[model samples]
Target chain A: MDSDIRLLSDLAPGQQAVISAVHADEALHQRLVALGFRIGRNVLLMRRGRWAGPLQVRLGATDVMLRRAEAGLITVRAA
Target chain B: MKRIALLGMPNTGKSTLFNRLTGSSARVANWAGVTVDLASAKILLGGHMAEMVDLPGIYDLHGFSDDEKVVRHFLEAHAIDVLAVVVNATQIERQLPLVLQARSLGLPLVLLLNMADAAKRHGMQVDTARLAARLGLPVVMISAKYGTGQAEALRVLAHSLDAALEIGPARHAALKSVLSDDVRIERETAEMMAEAVTQPLLLPEQVSDRIDRLALHPWLGLPLFFVAMLVMFQAVFWLGAPLQQGLTGLFDQLRQSALEPLAAVLPDFVRGLLLDGVYAGFVTVAAFVPLIVLFFLFMALVEDSGYLARAAFLTDALMGKLGLDGRSFVMVLMGFGCNVPAVMGTRMMRERPLRLLSMLVIPLSLCSARLQVFLFIVSAIFRPAQAPWVIFGFYVASFATMILTALLFRGRFRNTEPFVVELPPWRVPTLRQVWMRGWLEVRHFLSRATRFIVLGVIAIWLLTNLPAGATPGSVATLAGQLGTLFAPILAPIGIDEKLTVALLFGFVAKEVMIGAFAVIYGLSGDALAHEFARNMNWVQAVSFMLFTLIYTPCMSTIATIKIESRSAAFAALSVLWPLALAWFTSFVFYQGMRLFIGG
Candidate 1:
């Protein structure tokens, strides 16, 4: 992995990235992929809830909120 | 008649489309299923009657969610002529893969681009004709909410269904190859979207983002959510109380002026049964309609505005600590209005274990019905200044009981499905839509609750009136004898022989417990309160309140749990666990308080 690349959770709010890979438990991996998270999809970190809650990300026009623990498994590259 | 099923991802305006096509009420919600699970209607299409079925939405066909499984199983089991796949035109990139997957089913397919009006406003375009030609499938751009190109969509749908009927095996064989390689679905969806639709690489500065700044703020979001909930709950009470009073007065007038004079020819006993027994129970339930309407009205506003999901996000951290997810928070909130719909609303939850756990704890919520009982009892004993404090104490107990129940049962139920919820953009709910949603819930409450109330009251009337004139609720009557026989079990909870009868009948509806008091003791208004004040002390009152707060909420709620969970064992557990908890808690409180106060 490139030094500039990081987990999707590390992106600051308002920062954008492209999902490089999704590494999760088989069920979660399927869910993420089924929800349009692909290798090359661009994602913009929208916001996070209080006390390390879910992170909201804008994948194209759709916004989804997922737990940060799930986001940690998805590696992303800075856009 | 041919069946055309409208299938799609969640919040694609599928219900709006169903309503548009069939001219019926599908009970629209921006959030997931609080209304009809599978709404079907008959429509005359191409001068032939056809069934238009709307199934529950799913994020993916092969997903693990119960809804997804239902959709997949439904498609395989049912012989449907056409599958009309609806896509949010604005979110085609995220939605198109579902379309591709649905296409793989080898059904006659018609692509309906819903929310085209919103897509247009967002500077997006989908060339439907070109896309249809490229994919070799019929596509129509229609905004289901705004009724744009609705007729064209229906016409194309009818043609697709007829074509499927005529070509049958040949068309299925041809369409089987439409999906090709499963691995290439993503790339194909991307390439196809690039060619057919033009959407902004970035959303055009959504209003949802601006509001979400504070609503989902790292620091302020959780507190703000509590504040929003507090306001919603209090608003229902503060607003509904006056209307309740007005309705009460109106019913009183109607009975005195109309029922009395009209029934003057009847015997006094018959009139008393009509006026005091059945009519009073009816009045209690009917007078509560305003509160239920307001409660659901605010619920619709919060849900339709899309803040409910935000609250879900905010609370997921806390809920996660309890072995539940954000979705459970929403169900618990709905329980505040009424546990029946809240338990039903658990259908949106994809996983069964968490949904079952939610059903168990939801009845523990201090729902408005429980609150009604508390208010009546609190006013009877506590001073006006102390009323709020006592009720607030019960609220605290409600939360504690909910948390405690979750903590103790969390091990048995295990954890929840991952919470990856989509936050739909805020759409200001129209008054008509709000009213429709509210009316649907109110009708649900009335239909299920009124049955239980009337039947329960009639049963109580029989128990009181039986054995050939036992003085109607006297010691010799069935109800009174039954209460006394059961009095030993309730004695620790500070509920007496007479209040015991009311509690037993209260399983049907808690709101009628006070009315039952009038029948049991043959007292009303100030006299009933005076009777209570003279008989009970602070310790006993508190114990009684705690017991009522935790017991089986109502019969309809238990029935909803049984039906929704589809497990008689679990439903029985739901009753037994709460009843046991109520007894234990009340025993501890009643005994401990007696020790402290030296009674």
Candidate 2:
């Protein structure tokens, strides 16, 4: 569990993982899901911007940029 | 009547979904609020009708943004029968919160997971029933691109409406209370995904790796980007040339054959006015109509096909260097077609400073109207040998000016409001969607251009027709008097009377500049060529050309800027700032050239 716990940005670009859980509220959750962060799907972190603030992740190749605050909510484990 | 609203984050294929379900492409984009207007259509649902309204995409219902207000107030006031939250299947996690929020709205909601084909290709799977049960709504996975599962989604929506009437007592509740149940629902959905869903095999890393490698490599990427931009511009210029020629030929023939015969029956004043003013004005404006239409076609293709997001992503590095926030790409792209839409598009930028700065810089982007002027002048003056390069140089100069100005204004905007843009999977845009969208944009431009050009030509004719009409050197000869009034101010800028009058009328609409030029030179075939060499002189002509290329955007663009920025001051600044910069730059160029040439 400790080894699996890492900042979502730590995932290699285009590597797959599942959103084990999310910490944000229902509104933020829905927004995240709207951006393809739903649980069980393989999420791929594609590109991260300067200072790792906003990153483009490929949730099945529909790439989207998400802020760290938003990204932090999606707890993922390498599949 | 029961109302069904389509809610989604910007660019989640909401409009595409709307089009697929309703069969109309009201300008879908990978960017936000491509459908700024709320468009509604009815679809037959299980022997009944469901009225669906496409709401503007807003990140939060809490925000004061126009789109947000549309969704927020509607939910607050009206009892929406069904809400179709069009979640981008490829980017589900981020899309989920909107669904949760929509759930809080207490509508009978159906989650339409769009972009599933792209999602599945990336090795992702979703348990539809689980997601549906978890959110306490029916969830249907569909690909808007392929129009798959759309009908099922609609059918589920039909059931939801029926369920709503049956379960009327359970409709209203606090969001917190409702979400407490959704938590349990989500837990069950997670289990459902574990049992029922199998993640598909995504193409192994190399394709994206190679593309991203070349696309983001600091040195290679910038040159590639410029080449790509040049290619797009070249497409706009060269590909549209034939169509433009054809349209021009049509108008020229019409003017000669139809209008020429009609001229004799009319009184001399009416005849002169028709040929010299109205017919001539339409020809000038209409010649560019094909070019505008083609450019819009190219624009819609780039946008709908997801190349725009790639451009945005690739140029983010350069944009950062210029101190423009991440969101300025949309505004800049909008500027290429017309600055007004570009200025208006800046409203999507959450940062006040970024929006304001975008408004200011957008007018300088050399829109289609200025492109017309550049093509006309450079072609007339320099010939094929030098025209393209000179025209390209103006683009480079404008680009340089935008970067410099944004750099100067960098510190003004400290931070951008957090931006999250979904890049829909790249696909070839459908011909039907592209053509319809292109036609709409062209229609908008033509209407605005024609209306403005008609009044403009008539007014200029009237002003010039007064105080001893058309007596050789009389002030009543349209060009002579207006030219006289404009001469003193433009003299220092190296413009003579003929060029001065054209530039003066040019401030009204850039398209009007052509009509003004034709009017000033008496509409002869070689009129532009002769005036450029004789009345304007090389230095003044070049100076005037540069000034016209950079100055205030057309009236339609000004109106668009006002709409997009949601600020009168920002809109006025968009017009004033560019004009001031163009004026100063032209003055410098002309003065420096005069001294250098020892004139």
Candidate 3:
């Protein structure tokens, strides 16, 4: 696991990270942006469910639950 | 009256402020998009009557979701006098872009920093003077939940409304062009947040975050959620039982004292109509008010406390396997109380397939109406000790059926939307707000009961009493004929002619099943229980409960399904599939029990 760059799913629960880039389609990208997920935004990987379930992440004051597959599309770096 | 539209990013306390301003209790939950349609109320603002419209929350004015489209169409169609943009003060960084977008819409604006108390508690200081100057709008700080600064907010809004100014065509085009640049908009919002806000050196952990740490824990979160639900259901029964019994006794007394006296003056048939048909049927549904109130009270608390979002997070994986999301689980839980609102609740889901699948499975939940009938049968046939477990087993079976139904239809629709939902901050819900919600729903239930329950009861009464001398609820009457026609088809499931007639009326409303039994047997309470005990063995009783659990939803549910789905074919399928499934499931259960236990 590279320290400089990793997928959002790689961030351990309670780990803080900053979004570096998003690798989804245009529509998903826009939706993510509208939810306050964007470059340079600080996000905390608050919790993840078992058996590769959805991940609950806190971005700004908003907490969002995203599927692991969707989480995988976001590239993040340790804050 | 001048119109003002309340607009904001999702979950900014917009609806709460709407209720505060208009004194109208629209549904206010912590989750986003709770207000799916436009809700309007007239209020006297600064002594001038004005209509306030609370539109569904939207992320962006140019967003493509259904809620956004609704807001867009509304702004285009209605000449709103003032656009009151409610911003969550604690999340000003994320909410400012929406405020800016609404500003660009060329409408006169008043900025309301709602949840100001929560923001102050977070150690965030918002310079309203600077913000007002920066945004070129009147800014008012208020706590919608606690009703703080409401008079100031109303005064500011009235002043803004009176001095409305329309945006010039050139300025509108330029503002639109500027908003189209997403990167620049984000940059500008960040800059604005930095200038107009100050934060403490050491920020405290949010109460919501601290709770979510345990509530959303990987290993313990699910168990905790289930325990919470178990407590809720137990509380519903423990607290609701006495009140339910009292209401039932009161209605019984009314029938005996008021309606029974009418027998002397009126003809016997008319006396029977007033007492047996009208009062019995109405009380049968109305007596469940306590149970309904408790259920909604708990539901409102869980939703307003922001726990439901964590529940959604906990269950998303399991729901994903069924081709649905965790929010659908909330709707299904609501179905346990009533299928009507549960079906309507699908509006919270933005995806068509998920909404449709949720609607399809909601009818299978063991609603309180069905639960009442099940309780009657189980208590009469099984021992008191075994009654609770028997009822629990029926609920387990209902869930199994709902899951199997979802799995069977998963291939028919595409899962377009990913699981992305906001976990709103936890708040101590005000009792007034909770009670207002409960009262509103109770009012809705009474109105629906008046329309469907009364009409259905009168029709059944006429069928059983027409042809003047025919024996009531016997083969010579129309109800009996209809029951006889359906009895052979239901015979394999252990439903006899009298039970079949009751089942026919049960289609009108499941609560009517007990009342129908009372009518058919001409018995009540202990006598009715005795009749049930003599007629039904344990195996037949279990089979009958199974049939009731899986069979077609009551008439009101079907009508709601038709309206929500907007498809005649889907409604027809809703009826046919459940009937088929019920028959097959009941037949299997009855045969299996008979073989193992040796009837």
The candidate that achieves the highest TM-score relative to the unseen native structure: 3
Better of 2 and 3 by DockQ: 3
The alpha-carbon lDDT assigned to residue B329 of candidate 3 equals 84
Local distance difference test, candidate 1 = 0.77
Q: Give the alpha carbon lDDT tens digit for every residue of B120-215 in model 3.
A: 999999999999999999899999889998999999988877776343345444544543554355457679879996532222457667787788
Question: Which window of ten consecutive residues has the lowest lDDT sum in model 2 chain B?
Answer: B27-36
Which residue pairs of candidate 3 clash? none
Query: How displaced is residue B437 in candidate 3, in Å?
Result: 1.9
Q: Per-residue error at B581 for model 1, in Å?
A: 0.9
User: How well is each residue in A1-79 modelled by candidate 1, as lDDT tens digits?
Assistant: 3686799999988899876656665456556755656454678998877677889998866789899888888888766
Cα lDDT of all candidates, in order?
0.77, 0.69, 0.78
- What's the TM-score of every candidate structure? 0.68, 0.65, 0.69
lDDT tens readout by residue for model 1, B1-599: 88888898866776567766776322221223221135566888887988877776678876646566556556644567989999989989999999887876778889999889889999998888798887679999998777989889889987887787775555544443442343255456678988998542332356667787888888888778777866776677678867876887888788779987998999867776666677776775576678778978998888877888888888898888888888888888878778887899889777788988898899999887777777777877988667766776787798789889999998888864777778777667777778898888778767766676777766666677667767887779898799789888998777777777778877778867766765655544455668888888988888888988898868889888999999999999999999999999999999898888887
TM-score-superior candidate, 2 or 3:
3
Candidate 2 off by > 4 Å: A1-4, A10-33, A38-42, A48-54, A66-79, B1-218, B246-250, B253-258, B469-488, B524-526
Two-chain DockQ for each candidate model: 0.35, 0.30, 0.33
RMSD of 1: 16.5
